[model samples]
Target: MPDTGRSERGAVSAARTRDFARFRHEALLLKALGISKPLIACMAQRAAVTGTSIETEVLASGAIDEEAYYGGLARMAGLPFVAEIPDGMINDGPALDCQLKEPTLVRLHCNGRAPVIALVPKITHIEGLASRVKRSACLGETIVITTPSAIRRAVWKAGGERRGRVAVHGLFQATQPLSARTVVTGDQGFSAGLLISGLLMLLALAPQLLMIILHLILSLFHLGGLMLRLAVLAHTRRHGSEHETMLQSADMALPIYSVMVAIYREAAVVPQLIAALDEIDWPRSRLDIKLVCEADDLETLAAIAKVRPGPHFEVVEVPAMQPRTKPKALTYALAGARGEFITIYDAEDRPHPQQLREAYHRFRLSSDKLACLQSPLVIANGGESWLSAVFALEYAALFRRLLPALGFYRMPLPLGGTSNHFRTAALTGCGG
Candidate 1:
């Protein structure tokens, strides 16, 4: 009690020593394993520049062999190393019953009573999970190191075994939808077909009268819709305001933000997408960026790999299925999102850096009913073409005017495909 300050100082000093010791230990292990000093220095430099773990950067940047890294990790952890995980080594019961493939950062080996985990060396919370997995699985966890690709294969296999081949299918399929929900329904198609058939029959029976009445009704409906849209635009132009003052301070702790980007054949835009994500104001640690790609889109996937996104980014490969739309890709990506808030961006989107912060603050200040935030969409190349200019104007009216008016009136919002931030729970509750 008399020397509490001295004790605290000593504890801090010891913690620093332990941290340095781990670094030195890894370096010595690499050297002892015959890794070159220059390569070791390169790993350290890349880790420093990318804000990723030394082990991960070394592996990703090709400075170290994957097998060597795993072996070295096993030695450092004092655990047995396996060059290859055997077939059925992970018991289907425990693996299927648990979320082994999720988070895309950890892989679970369920062969024994104890769970073996291959986790990202830097990002994984070994201390916190030690008790949790043991309590949940009724087995102690054995931690190891593995690359992201290894875990992806494990997850895909486990899911297929557990949920059938459709487990890997994106949320939408023509044969069977994911749940009670569907992005498009047969009922809608049937109804549309019925309406067209009835209209044709009417035209055949009494063309003159039916055409006149149909035109009148359609014209009125169109006029009313345009008037309502104009009204919203007028209101927006008069009172639209930014939540500039509501922005949080930079010192405030940032919550995890999930960003979903779906790319099919967009190889050329992959670099731009990465650049746009990097430009976000939020810390990389707090940004969970999922680049959703189709399994068959090898070109786009290759482009993404060439970009070499940092630890914050993940590549979610959606198994090819019917109704191959962006929403389908997003639905697949949604299953693995780990964040408090989620948002979407297109292949060419370049949202403001402060967008995430503003959205977070707006949600905090808003009522519980306010579950989503729509960012304004602006076209940067409107001057280049007449069609582009028209598209730009339409977007301006839709995002700025109509959406704001709809929000103000508490009316149902027709959500735009991208830049719409949502509360994660709310989205998942509605079968994201």
Candidate 2:
């Protein structure tokens, strides 16, 4: 047999050589386009430090906006540059969603010609594309270049209705038992009704005995809840949190972290909400913030448009549907989430600036069984009323202390509605 070890070594060597050749090829092209040697060297260093590509470092650093860089790419390849890809020019399909992730190609029909729109698949391919364009004028006419954002926008618009359907029904359809859509299953409802009716009939016949039995059952349930709380309390006091320091800092290349905010008629707080989102400390290029608003809430949409959040932020308008709740709004927007991990926040919550960083760090350290990290939600208006104060205390005892203990002790952990981070794959696997 052939020497397997030698073959593997040869493959590794060949891969390194190709990487070197591509790096040199891209560097020479950038130099030809008037990029100074010093600037290139700076970006190259930044790329190494972050464990990212020169292209990623360049775009994220704001050295060159997508328009200028992709336009330059179009020019070099002798292809036309499209400022925007019209929704009407493209066709939507089930597989069209693949473009939302990588955005390599989108075929367009314009003026009776099918011109193929593309983003540069790789820097090394530009020379080959330019060569092909020179060899065939027809190929040049058939090809065009555009930014990734343009392609995503076109896909979002084309699939708006479909996305809405998926967002609304995805969870319920995938896993009915997990969905809150139905209050209870038919069998569960029947059992509950039968139990309640039997207890009432027994009370009518033997009031004293029924009362004693009822007291015993209720007391047992109460004691169980009490024990669960105390166990968590004791665990917390003894060990403290494993994430007190927010784990180690993530200097390496970070995956896209998506932040989703579902708002209803809270137009008055739009400015504050946008400001809070802007304060999160993360790379702009890797942050995907989705502001999910109801379709009928024109005021909130108008307010967001007026504020004009960055390109990293996008508005996902969910169609007005039944059970018009925050969770439903969040569920609807999940279809369009483009991130490795995602989190939900309310309109008024000003999350800690380092919250995303901490969440990512914890996820890296934890095992796959760890599906989510629920950030403690503290109530701000506790001092306003006695009722509010009690609620705030409940939140503190449950989230800040109890839940962490429950997880540490391998007990059942219930998640809150907002301020929880989840791995996208795990979330989708559990039907979102």
Best by TM-score: 2
lDDT of 1 by residue, 1-432 (tens): 489999999987886565445556556656665678887666755444444445555655555566666666545444445555544544444334233223234445564456666554432333344445546653223655565445555564455333323333423343355543565588988999999998899899989989898899999999999999888767767886544585755522566789999898999999989998988887554578889888889999999999988766878877776657776677666666778899999999988888898899888888887778888889999999999999999888788777778878888888888899999989867656
> How well does model 1 score by local distance difference test?
0.69
Alpha carbon lDDT at 266, candidate 1: 94
> Roughly what TM-score does model 1 have, to 2 decimal places?
0.68
Off by over 4 Å in 2: 1-42, 118-124, 207-216, 240-244, 319-323, 381-388
How much does each candidate deviate from the true structure in C-alpha RMSD? 8.1, 6.3
If scored against the real structure, what TM-score would every candidate get? 0.68, 0.83
- Quick one: best lDDT, which candidate? 2
1-432: candidate 2 lDDT, tens digit per residue:
899999999997886566555466667777776677887767765555455666766766666777888888888888889879876888778688877666788888777666675564455578888898899998776778888778877877777677667767877887778777889899999999999999899989999999899899999999998997788778877998665566555455587889999998999999999999999988766788999898899999999999977767878877777667777777666766889999999899999998999899888888987878899999999999999999999999988888878777687888888899999999877766
Write down the lDDT of every candidate, Cα atoms only. Answer: 0.69, 0.80
Tell me the spans in candidate 1 whose CA falls farther than 4 Å from its real position: 1-73, 81-153, 160-208, 237-243
